[model samples]
Target: MSAPERIPPRGVTTDEPLAGLLTHGELTVRGRIREASNAALYCTVAHEGREAACVYKPVAGERPLWDFPDGNLARREVAAYEVSEATGWGLVPPTVLREGPYGEGMVQLWIEVTTEGDTAELLALVDGEEPEPGWKAIGFADVGDDRTALLVHADDERLRRLAVLDAVINNADRKGGHLLPTAEGRLYGIDHGVTFNTENKLRTLLWGWAGEPLTPEALEVLKGLQDALGAEGALAGRLSALITGAELDATRARVAVLLETGRHPEPSGEWPAIPWPPV
Candidate 1:
């Protein structure tokens, strides 16, 4: 099939309007984003004379994971967005699941963030090495061939909040590339299909705050999440539709642990602490 028409990111403000379109819009595949491991189509969605840019990940296109159940990655992606919204952190862009050209799939509003030059340089800094004043070094790793690479994350408050969000979601695949930076300096996290596992698979590149005390602001957010997940609440109900009961329970457990510990988690070392090809 031919790709859908391309629509630039302009006047795409507010989630409700975009979300309504994703839920009930006409989606056309614009092009295939070749960088993704699974099939991901870039498309323009139109509804009621309005148009927006979005990425579509059809369920049939998903590569099965041994640990995760089949045919549900799309739903998990939406669940991550729900958690982000509930916490009011806005770490995730607006996303939703609906029938598309390729059957049921995930449709999320595309975020146009920094993808070259200065942004790349900031993320590639060596670990333990100070970042240009405002930035902070989180962790470092050996990138083979006797070379060591640092895993530095932005020290901005928004990025730090996202680190906590990843921990709660059990995100097993938070590569550096998943962190998107907007023109206005806001950071957004994307590609959350591998999240919400019952296991302790919180692997990511945002360990800069490891073992450090959780800021008051972070603790408050955690508390809010806990409340939102209470029995009969909308957030809890939404999550139930996407992940298993055990996985949902485990997510709450993780939040409780974080609340009790009041600090960033250290790597368990049982599994790979960081994702391969980090950036």
Candidate 2:
């Protein structure tokens, strides 16, 4: 059977179901993986001969301690990915919120496991163990040999553009595991729950060319992204409303800074490492 034309949800952006495509049944939760911050069982789901995976976040509706308010992190994640799709960068894959038996969470396309091994093995390669030539691995690590050209080729234009955005947003969780290199030589970035705000949480290892001028191609991409993001004021406004007043103002400051300077300032120890528990 042919797949239905996928359409993003309208009106209330939060918790928009994936239409009749998903049925009310036990979603086989294989590979129940867990991340550092959120307490959820991530697993792969299959349907109509197509397979995808999602982070099964169990929400008990309890308020948790964190920077951003509780009961809104998942929603922000959905919105961010949706806006990323609109940006036309393909930085983040398409995602939608689904109603699970436990609690409502997001369901995004499972990144095709193309890399040969886990992030640890990839880091081992960075440690001079070298996982063959031309293989790319990604995760959260400092900006050193762990992120050298082996995992990400120096000439990969797409990743270079993504690095710019990562710098601007002050992404804190750019570990080696969050990067996925496809067989077609394209790289996909993931785990963007902390961005858009302006708390100076910037921490990444892709600053090999810091203070250097963006390539003409990369500059064009960034300018185009800013324009596209401007048109979709609805997306940004929604995200801003979810965060605090200071955070919103900070996000605006960051946006302006990115537009003007086009270079991320050095990292600062202002905000905490993680957003909060139950994230």
In candidate 1, residue 85 scores what lDDT?
88
Position 25, candidate 1: lDDT: 86
Candidate 2 lDDT score at position 265: 47
lDDT agreement of model 1 with the native: 0.82
Total backbone clashes of candidate 1, pairs 3 or more residues apart or in separate chains = 4
List TM-scores for all candidates, in order. 0.90, 0.64
| Candidate 1 lDDT over residue span 171-269, tens digit each | 998888888777666677899999888889988887778889999988999999999898877899999888888888988999999999999898898
lDDT of 2 by residue, 133-206 (tens): 53333323344765633333233556566667676445666555676666554456676665554457765544
Each candidate structure's count of clashing pairs: 4, 9
- lDDT, each prediction: 0.82, 0.51
Q: What is the lDDT of candidate 2?
A: 0.51
